[model samples]
Target chain A: MTKESKKDGGVNPRDEAKERLENFALKVLESVNQIEPPKISIPSRSTSNIVFDEKERYYTISGKTVTRTSANMRQVKKFAQTMCAADFCKDLIESKKTATLREMYYISEGWETGGFADQGRSDRIVEDLESTFGVKREDLGLLPEEDGASIFGDIVIDEGGMEVKATKVGRAGYTIPPTMSDVEFVECGADCVLAVETMGMYHRLIQEEAWKKFDALVVALKGQPARATRRFLKRANKELDLPVYLFTDGDPFGFHIAMVVISGSAQLAYINHELAVPEAQFIGVTASDIENYDLPTDKLRESDVQRLKQLLKDPRYSDDIWQSEIKKMLNLNKKAEQQAFSKYGLEYVVDKYLPEKLT
Target chain B: MTKESKKDGGVNPRDEAKERLENFALKVLESVNQIEPPKISIPSRSTSNIVFDEKERYYTISGKTVTRTSANMRQVKKFAQTMCAADFCKDLIESKKTATLREMYYISEGWETGGFADQGRSDRIVEDLESTFGVKREDLGLLPEEDGASIFGDIVIDEGGMEVKATKVGRAGYTIPPTMSDVEFVECGADCVLAVETMGMYHRLIQEEAWKKFDALVVALKGQPARATRRFLKRANKELDLPVYLFTDGDPFGFHIAMVVISGSAQLAYINHELAVPEAQFIGVTASDIENYDLPTDKLRESDVQRLKQLLKDPRYSDDIWQSEIKKMLNLNKKAEQQAFSKYGLEYVVDKYLPEKLT
Candidate 1:
C-alpha cells in the first residue's frame, strides 16, 4: 500500500507496526467485552489469490479476504495464535527487540494454549499478520532466520549508528545481516550491484577483485536470495542508484531465484513493494552461456526438467529473455553451476565471463 | 608437522605447497618417462587409521599408508586425476589464484579421462592430495565452498595486506573467509571468543551487543562448523590467545559440532593442527541448560537419540562433562535449541543465558 507513518507526520515503521498491533488487540478485546465475536480478517494468500501486478512489475495479492474468528472451533486455535502472535510482536517492539521466526515458534511453547505445534503453522500466521496489517514481518519486528550472505566493495552503510565501509571489511566481505531496516546506505562509489547466486563464484570474484574492475558492489545471494538479501539489493539498487544484475547457474532453479529477486516470489507477494528490485537484470549462466562459454554442465535431472516446464507458465518468467532461456535450457537437457565457468580456469569467471556479461 | 616454509629462510605456505607439487610432478614425470609405474603413497585416512592424539587434543592419522598406482585399471583413473589436480593447483598458485573445491571438480570436467563422474570422487582426490603431501588443501590453493559465517566484536585481522576491525564493520560483522591462512590476527580487545552454532542466536547476541557484555568476540558457526569457520576460530584462539567457548543447541548434533571445533573430526584428521582449537569449551545449551533455564524443548527424535548414542562412544566426547550431558539428554528424551532461551524473551540468550554461561 503506502509507507507507514505516525500521527505527528513522521515515518516510524516500528512504531507504526506497534500501533497497528495495539489497535487490532483493542478491537478484539472490546469485541470480547461486548460478548461479540472476536475475529481477524486476513487477505487470502492462496495461489489463486496471487496476481502478477504488471504495473508494479511484481507478484501481489488480489482483493480477496478470509476471516478467522474465535467462534468456530476449527478456526479458534489459529485465531488465538494470531492474537497471541500480535501480542508477542507488540512486546518485542515495546522492548526495542525482535524475534526470529524459529525463535517465535519456540517462544510460543510458553503460551498457555496458543503454542504452535510446528514452524510452518507459526510462519503462516506471521504472513497472515503481515497481510492483515499491511506491513512487512520485518516491520513487525519478526525476522526469518536467514543464511549468512555477504556484500563486498565500495559502499558505506550506517548500521544502527556506526558507519562501516564494505571495502574496509574482512577478506570475505561484510556479512549481510538478518535485517536491513536498521542499515542506511551512507555512500556508494559503485555503478551497479552484482548479486552472485553461489558463494563459490562470489568468493572467486572477490579474490580476483572483480568489483574493482566493474566498479560495482558484489553480494553473494547464497542460493535463492534470502529476504534480507533481496531487501539489501533493493535498497542498494534504489537508494544508491545502482543497477542490479543477478548472476546464477544455468538451470530452472537459478533462473527462478533471479526472477524472485527481480519481480518477487508469489509466495512472498505481500512484501513485494518493499523487497522486490524490479529493475534487477539476470546476467548469465543462462542456457546460452553454456554454449557461448563452452562451460561444463551436468545433464538436467528429472526434477530440473519438470521445474523448467513449470517455469514456462510462471508469469515472472514470461519475458522474452526468461522464456527463451528456460526453453533453451529444457531443449539442451543440461544444467551448469556458476562454478562451471572454472572449466576455463579459476579466474575465467572473474577475469573473462563477468566482464563480458556486465560490460 | 612443522610450519611450512620456503628454502630461503622465510615462511611462505603457498610457495611451499607449490614446490611440493612441482617436486611430486617431476618424480611422476621421471617415473613415466622411465617406463616405471607412477605411484603415490598417501597416509591412510580410514577410521582404523584415526587415533586420539591426547597430547595434541585432536584426532589424527596413525602411521599407516596406502598406495595408488597407474599400474591397475581402477587406480589408473585416480592416479591420473591426482596428477591433473596437482597440475591444476600449480597453475592456480602460479597465477596467484585459488579454486573452490566445487570449481576444481567442475574444472576437471575438461580433463578428458581425468574428469570425475561426480563431486564426491573429486572431493576424495583433494583429501587424498592433502594427506599425501602433508599440506592442507588451502595451502595447495584448493578452497572449500563454505557457508557465510560472521565475526563480531573487538578484533583486528590482517586480510591480505589490509587490516580490518571486526567491531567497526556492518551490523552482521566481518564475513569469515574460506581460507584463514592469509588472515593474520593484528589486534584484539576481547578476552575470549564465543562460537555460536546457529545464526539466529548469533544475530540475537549481536542485536544485544553481547560481545560488549562478556568481552568476547562472537562468531556464528552456522550449523556444523564449516572448515573455514573452524579455521577462523582456531587462528583467533591460538594467535590472539583468546579462549574460545562454543555455544550450541542442547542436542546430540549440537554437542558433536562443538566437539568438532574443540577436537578435529576424524574425516579431516590431517588438518587438525591447523583447524582444531583444543582449548575451546562448550559454553552450554547443554542438557543441563534444559533444566537450569527451564527452556522449551522437543522430544528427542529417533535420529537425535541415535546420534547421542554414537557421540557417547566418540573419543572427542569421552570426557566426564560430555558423557554426563549425553546421558542426561537420553534420560530426559528431550533436546533444545539455542533459541529455546527466547521463550523467556528475545534478548534472554544474549542478555542472560550467554552472560551466565560464558562468565
Candidate 2:
C-alpha cells in the first residue's frame, strides 16, 4: 500500500484518495517513458485471492496480484480502460461530484477507445482501481444504485448538514443513502442494531415501538442488502459501539444474508474490511425456533435441502450454532419465515420472539 | 354481484366487505344443509376473463366465472381453502388486525386438509376471495409486502392519524406503506405527480429541490412497482386532482410500466378500477429523445426486441403515440435510461430535461 493510503489520522480521506490516484498516474507516465511496457498491477479479485481471516472473522483479498501490460493484446484495452477510469475519478474528485456506476457506464461512451462494451466491464475496472488504491469507490466519488435499506430508532444521522433523528422519520424510517462517507452517526442511545432480512418484520418492530422498549436500532436489510447497507451497519457497529444482530427467515438463504453482514461474501472479499461487521450475531428464525415456538412452517423444497447441504460445507457457517441449525433443518425438512410468528399474533414477533432472542 | 357488494354509496367499505363475505358464508351454509352439493362461484382472474375497458382505459375482469364444488375431487381442496381464507378474513375483520400475505400463507398450516402446499396456492386463494367478494385484499385485512416507492414534494400524507409533509421527510422521501387504505392525502400543492422509474433520478430531483421549483411530486417507482404504489398514485390523481406523469427508460419494459399505470395490466384486471390511474401521461425518455437530446444509448437486446414486438400487438399500446414510439425504438434499436441525461451533468436532468417536459 502507498503512504497516502496508509495514513489514517489528520489527513482528509478525499485528498488522500486524490493523492493515491496521482501517484498511480505518475507511475503509468514513468512506465510510458521507460524502456519497459506501460503496465499496472492490481490485486486480483478472483476467488483464489480470497482468504478467510481467522482473527478478523471476515474474508479478505490476499496478496495475490495480476499485472497488466500494454504489450499484451488482451491487456492493452484493459490497461487503457484503467487509465481512462483513473482520469474519470480524478475529474470527479477535483469537481467534488459523484456519479453512479450506471452514469459512469454511460459516460464511458465518450471515452472512444477506452469506452466499455458493457457495464460489467466498467464495473470491474472500478473494483480494480478500488483494490489497487486501497480506497473505496465512494472516496473516488463513484456511487452505487440506490439501496432500499432503511434505518429507524435510537440514533441521529448527520446527513447533508442536517441532524436527522431516525425515530422522528415516518414508519418507513430514514433510508441509508448510497454514499455514506460524509455521513456521521451521532447521539446513539441504542445498545444494539437489529439488521432484519424482511421489511414486514422491520415495520412490525417499528410499529410496535420495539426500539423504544429494547433500546435498539432497527434496520430493514430488504433481502441480500446492497453495499450501502452493509457499510452503514459496519460504521454503526464500530462508531456507535453498539452490537449488531441479524434476524432472517429460518432458511438457508437467510443464513447466507446474515453471513454476508458478519463475515462478508466471497464475491466482495476485497472490501470486506469496510463492509463486514465481524462481531454481529445471528438472532433467530432458526430451525430450533420452528420447534420451540411451534411456529407454522413448510416442508423444505428440494432446492432448500440442496442449499442446506451446501451451507453445511461452507467455511463461514462452520460455527457450532450454524452447524447445529443446518443439521436440524436438514433432518426435520422444514423451513419457516420471520413472518411465521404472526400465526400467534400480529405483534408476536416484536413482543414475544424478539424479546426472547435479544435478551 | 351480490347487492351487499354493490352497496358502495353510504356504507363503510370495510363494513360492506364484511357483509359481502358474510353473505357468501351464509349461501355456502345453506348449500351444505341442502341436498345439492355445496359449490361456490367466483369471477375468473384468468387471461380469458380479462377485458379492455375502452372508456376507462384499463383492463377489467369480464363476466366469465368458474364454479368449484366440494363434490369434485380435483377442486375439493381449493373449495375448502377458499372457505378457510374467508373464515380467516372474517376473524381479522372482527379483531381489527392485519396480516401480510406471507403470514396468511403460513397461517394456512393450521387448516388441515385446507392447508396450501405452497405460497402460490395460498396467494391465489386470497385473490380468489378478493374477486369473489368484490373487495380488496386490504379490505379483508390482508397486506402485501412492503414496497420501495417513495413520494417527495408538495403533499401531505395523513398516515396513521398524523399529518406528514412529504418534503419534511428525509431525502429518501415518504415510503408508500403496505396498506394505504387508512392513509389520507391532504394539502396537495403539486400540479402533477411524476412517477419516476428509477430511484437514482428520483433522488436527483429531490436533492436538486426540483419539487420547489416545478411544484411537482416526484415518486420513485423502483422498477415494476408494488400494488400499494399504484393504489397510492391512483388516489393522488383521483382524490388530489393532480395530473400523473410517468418518467421511465426508453425501453419496452419501461413503456409497459407507464401503460400499467395508465391502462392497467391483464394479470391484475380484477382490481384495476381501484389501482389504475387512467389519466396518467408518459413523459420523455422516448426513442426520439436519444437523438434529440444526444443522450447515451444501448442497443436493444434480444429480449427487448421480443418484448417490443409483443407490445406492438398488445391492445394497450394501440395509441398513435405508443405505436410511433415503439416503432421508433425498433427502427433505432437503441434504448436509454433516465440517467442518460447525466452525460450533460447531474443537474441537467432536474434543470433542463424535467423543466422542458413539465412546461
Which candidate's DockQ is highest?
1
**Candidate 1 lDDT over residue span A1-359, tens digit each:** 11121111136677888899999989998998999989988899988999999998999999899989999999988898888888889888888787899989988987766578789999999999999898778778888777746888887777667888887887688776676666766677788889998888888888889899898788998888788888888877766668999998888778888888889988888778888998998895888889887877889999999989998898777889878888898888888888887787777887888878876
User: Comparing to the true complex, what docking class would candidate 1 get?
Assistant: medium
Interface Cα RMSD for all candidates? Answer: 1.7, 2.1
lDDT of 2 by residue, B241-353 (tens): 77898999888888888898888889889989988998898895998888899888889999999999999999888989888889999999999899998777678888889
> What's the TM-score of every candidate structure?
0.91, 0.88
lDDT of 1 by residue, B188-213 (tens): 77888888888788888887888888
TM-score of chain A of each: 0.92, 0.94
The regions of model 1 sitting more than 4 angstroms off are: A1-10, A25-38, A70-80, A112-114, B1-10, B26-38, B69-77, B110-114, B355-359
Docking class of 2: acceptable
lDDT of 2 by residue, A1-359 (tens): 00111122235566788999999888878877886788888899888889999889899999989998999999898888888888889898887667788888877777756467788989999999899998889888888775658888777776656667776656678877777666666577788888899887887787678888887888999999988788888877776667899999999889889999999988888889989998999995888999999877779999999999999888888889889989999998999889888777677788788889977
- Candidate 2 lands at a TM-score of 0.88
Report residue B17 deviation for candidate 1 (angstroms). 2.0
Minimum summed lDDT over a 10-residue window in model 2 chain B is located at B1-10
